[model samples]
Target: MELQQMRYVVAVAETNSFTRAAELCLVVQSALSQQIARLERELGARLFERTSRRVRLTPAGAAFLATARQCLQAADRAVAEVAAAVGEVRGRLAVGLISTVAAVDIPGALREFHQVHPSVRISLRGTASEELVEQVREGTIDVAFLGLPTTARPEGVHARELAHDRHVAVVAPDHPLAGERAVGLRRLAAETFVDLPAGTAGRMQTDQAFAAAGLDRDVAFEVTNADLLARMVREGLGAAMLPSAYVPQLTGVVTIEVTDAPARVEYVIWSRSGPTPAAAAFLALLGIPAS
Candidate 1:
């Protein structure tokens, strides 16, 4: 039936009480009852059964409720699409990103986005790659950027490789291996390593590379964020394996390429709800070759 009728039906179904539903719908109980009655009449079915103690949906009402929700959702989406088309783009865009993106590019990108689309609000939340993907699937974010396994692509989300980062080993400048041009995988077998926490994409990739090269190194410490990881490397807590770009020019720390490791690439992923103009514009500035 009509979108308004669907809204009324859903409100009644959720509250399970006409009086409370009407209050939530911001209308009088009598008016809401009239709309529900009209909807049932149009469908030629009895929608809800009422008794002294409580209200319950009839079998027909239960069936109609599912379709009613879909109708209401579609209508709301239509309104949002129309607004975006007119360049009025005046809604919130929620984004989920890995910690490094927020630390590396998000602040600058968001600054530029705000300058051009001041009307569109943004809420940014950062987490590990797996967590960010879950947020996107749950409809908590409009999009995400993270590094994850090429295997197990999530349904209904488009992922694109943005840039490749060579995972490097960071050692203090005065360390024994610092003078070497490149650190071979076998040489690092017995070295004390500092790395990101376990169960992260970075850790998994590191493990895979070490396994591939027949290398096994003892991890001396685990740090969570890029900045801190870099600092710990500088302090000589241990040599670390992390994204090359994240390595800082600490006085004591030097970056050495991993001779046998596969590079970790950053990926841009968006919910299939489709990209908004603001998100697209920011991506353009990043020089992402294609949408």
Candidate 2:
């Protein structure tokens, strides 16, 4: 069987949906299905039991899945090893990060990488922490920089921390409690807050902290951009709880330390299996050790 067919098998098995697997492999659904069918016919057994609602592996398919994965992994390693031997980093590198991430100087790092490896084509995408994690896990992006809550860690990925800081509350200078050294969630129950929308990692972190403190405050404004949130606070729109680095943009807003707030950790994450040569070179340029 060809390596591409083996790759198709592993992808289908992992996702459990032919359509999704085809999308992940960057191929047409019909072609992928026909190739897998051809492999099954050659093996003289039905590998997958397909129903209308779901796709599942038959006994033979289950037994062959492990070998299929191994073959794909081996092929990947073989290519990586040869690329390493060639000592030329010239390929596509896809990197994802959150918009509010200030832990690493991404622009500066990219500039340096371009100077060092001019032949490499670099692509960068700014997105939310949850989305970044999903992209890295799926190998759509070679690496991602993520800001994670204290209680959260990415699964099935290799992560390297670049920075760590704590969350703080910000409000207009004339707002009540602006001069306080530190504030607690219990004292802010009646206040309206400006924050990120639900489902984002930053929002999830703050929500968990509020839930743990047994306080439910009103979110008066929801913004995805850090500068916009800071502007909302500066304009007396509302108060907000945000990461330390994202606070300085609130020029006129007063930042009050949040007591017992969850710590925010920034991490450089990649697929656990391996990183492409271009990705490895970019990581090295950023001073992150090889995974």
Candidate 3:
């Protein structure tokens, strides 16, 4: 019935352990358990099936979980709106981004945002661009930075274009194409490549470009991390096509311009419903006007 009890239920359900949820909620395990017990008694149903090995939500708990989260989000937004009205920005800011984000200096921007609004709590998640867009739409993430093909745009969210760049061929220093000032996709397609996993936005750009050019290439390795992809390229596992802006940060690899390279666009996206005050402040920092 109480907000705190609902919070306890939500925390326990998410963590799947009373002990871990207690740690996250900054409450003693006994206290959190006792509160949830009280809540269950009041609700006249058991919310969780607790076993020594694991905790699972009961049917009733599953039904309650979504509403509990919405209530909590609403409460937090109410408090944040009140603070905003008083010229204060205080709330949680959950930001998501892809690994190949070269358009924005994320850490530097976060540092500056924190310095200006020390009252806000900030968290960052790194994931594939499509997932970031979905998370933004779901409201789980307050804002996101994404890199997608120039032909694509994040759907169901408010997005602002940040930067546009083309992919460059990355090869080991001793590779045959390393010394080339520029190469066309037809030439590069014959070499083995290392790229992001199939179906990801990052991979789709290259895939679509090659498919359009009627060229078929082998991707010998699929990596999720940009740094790991660079390492793979450096060790001569395979060549990689990465954003030109990102290639400058890698060493032990040679970057060659691709005449028919796939173009990528960077964007900052937020919920279409409207940004929270914290998200609004961050967007303002990025020069995006409130909508």
Candidate 4:
């Protein structure tokens, strides 16, 4: 019932060990267990099923965990908001970005944010654009940078386009197409390709381009990392099409313009409901007006 009790329950649930949870909470194991027991008695439901070997959340505990987390987040946000009113921003900022993000210098931005709001905690993660969008909606990520095909836009979130650029063909220095000034999708389709996995946002842009051109390309290498994709091209394993802005960062590959290439849009997205104080400050630093 009490917030302290909920905190203990959450810690136990996350660690799955009463001893570890006590350590995390900076309290004795017996004290943490006693508080949880008291909470369970008040709720008339056993929150966890504990055995000699391990501790697991019971059905009732699983049902209550989500709301407990939301409540805790709300309480923390309330405190942070009050602190912000007094000219101090104190909260956690979780930022997500696609692996190929080039529109914004995330490291520089984080450095400035830290200097301005030294008390705020920040974390960054890189993944696919779609997964980042999902994380923002789920409240795990406060803000994100995304890249998607020009024809596609993020749904169910607030988004602002940052930049747009066409993809260029990259090949080994000695490859047949390396000396070409420009080529079309059809020309690239004839060569084996190295790209992100199928069904991902990064791969979709290239895939849609090929599909629209009535071409079927062979993707011999599927890699999640952009550097590895460039490596594959450098070793003559396959050719690749990557955003123009990101190409300069890779070495040992020849970049050629694609005359009829797919264009990708870079966007900054946040929760539609609103942004946390730390996220709002970050957006402001990026010159995006508050929504």
Candidate 5:
């Protein structure tokens, strides 16, 4: 069967109305129905059960629908790959990032990439590190910048450390420990803290460090955005632990070294297989050496 026939089948299955599917496919209803009929004849299976009330998929059609969609997607991907190989970068690149990212200079890199591959389209999404990792695994995003523990490597993902900055304690400029160059983790254990929610890479690193030190912090607030976390610290809401880059330098918040906290590492993560040409170009823009 032709790819157009598969598209017609998928369109009918998704819309559930031959008339509507025809409209969506930019074809007349009779032509769409004829194509579907021809596909069923070729396969020697009744793909749809017709009734006056609604168009429904038969058992055979139900089973074939998923496979048809996959075939369409694969065909589209193959075409895109060939086009990118012979022409300028001109495909969609879905990119993911954590809200607290301050490393890798994504904006700068995108600016440079745009100059070279103006036809390429970049779609960016910001979320938690865990969600970003999941998106990468599921192929929702082609590549992402994620916060990961120094030694924790996730399965089925290719990751490269893009940048690393020591985790630091941020406090109000007038706080008692603000004058010190560095302070131990235990010193802040008794103080109320503002931090990222649990399971996030930032929070995970802090928790691991505290666990290693046999100390527990009094977390008074949880925030996902680093700017909001910084605001909380500047407002004297609580002390915070964050990567040095995430803390705004010109703001009233003061960043000091946490003597025992490990460095927060930003990794460029992608699926182990099936990277699009746009993704490869984007990675190169991010300065990841070609493998």
Candidate 6:
């Protein structure tokens, strides 16, 4: 009639003693007896033949005992399989990254994550800060190394800041500004810019920094990828304003300090809950110190 009733029936059948089965189950004999009586009444069958001296199963009781034991065993196996799925530290890690983060950090983290979890398959996606946030929210990716100030503040996500990306100005290796150790926002106003898209917070900061000095930029070109921006600058395109990490060592591009540029921080994020085992491991991987 119920799982507890089935368990009681099986236990009594196994031990051949109501008193011993009750002891085995840590329940009083009278409680076990009453429950068995209720189960028998519910099934409309007498499950045991009781005497003052002994208790023995009816023919129906023997048949039911075997089925009940199998049912309990199956329940155990199901529970164990579910526990292993939720708790195992191996599986696929679907990771998304802002394009610039991939340029700087993903390679090292990818190598380390593989070393620690060889069986885990890593799926990587490259996109912008806003796009990466949406991917995490929609369950298209398990985790992301996305740039911050995600416009939507997507529901059901958790984030951890790995590093703050300080802004740096990049120019051709032989450009006159390249000789300067550090350049000010006012000086940048005269130079045409290769900037991030107009709608980005990065662009806003770039604008505000110069505005503070009673100056404004004439953005000559606009593009999203920092690596691409570096290549453009190397080919004598307009100077790019972005983080040093993204343009570390382009062949013909030189990065210089921007006196009062804003920092664009990066984060490694995961689902607030329901992170697959591998996703959890990957988030842990992000926190690992660089080797």
Best by TM-score, which number? Answer: 3
lDDT of 2 by residue, 1-291 (tens): 888888888888889999999999999999999999999988999889999999999999998887886676556556655767788776667899886787888888989999988877789998888898888876768889889887888778899887888888888999988989998888766789898888799788888888888889899789987888888888888888888886764588898998878678888998887777878888888888865
RMSD of 2: 5.5
lDDT of each: 0.74, 0.84, 0.93, 0.92, 0.83, 0.73
RMSD of 4: 2.3
**Which residue pairs in model 3 clash with each other?**
none
Residue by residue across 48-88, what tens digits does model 3's lDDT show? 99988999999999999988987888799899999999999
Number of the predicted model whose lDDT against the real structure is largest: 3
Across 151-170, the per-residue lDDT of candidate 6 in tens digits comes to 22334577666666677888
- Models 1 onward score TM values of 0.67, 0.71, 0.93, 0.89, 0.75, 0.62
Give RMSD to native, each candidate. 7.5, 5.5, 1.8, 2.3, 5.4, 19.1
Worst 10 contiguous positions by lDDT, candidate 3: 132-141
Off by over 4 Å in 3: 41-45
Ranking of predictions according to TM-score? 3, 4, 5, 2, 1, 6
Q: Higher-TM-score candidate among 5 and 6?
A: 5
Clashing pairs in 6: none
Candidate 5 pairs with clashing backbones: none
Error of 6 at 282 (Å): 1.3
Task: Output candidate 1 Cα RMSD.
Answer: 7.5
Regions more than 4 Å wrong, model 4: 9-22, 46-59
63: Cα error in model 5, Å: 10
Question: Candidate 2: which stretches are off by over 4 Å?
Answer: 1-84
- Which TM-score value belongs to model 1? 0.67
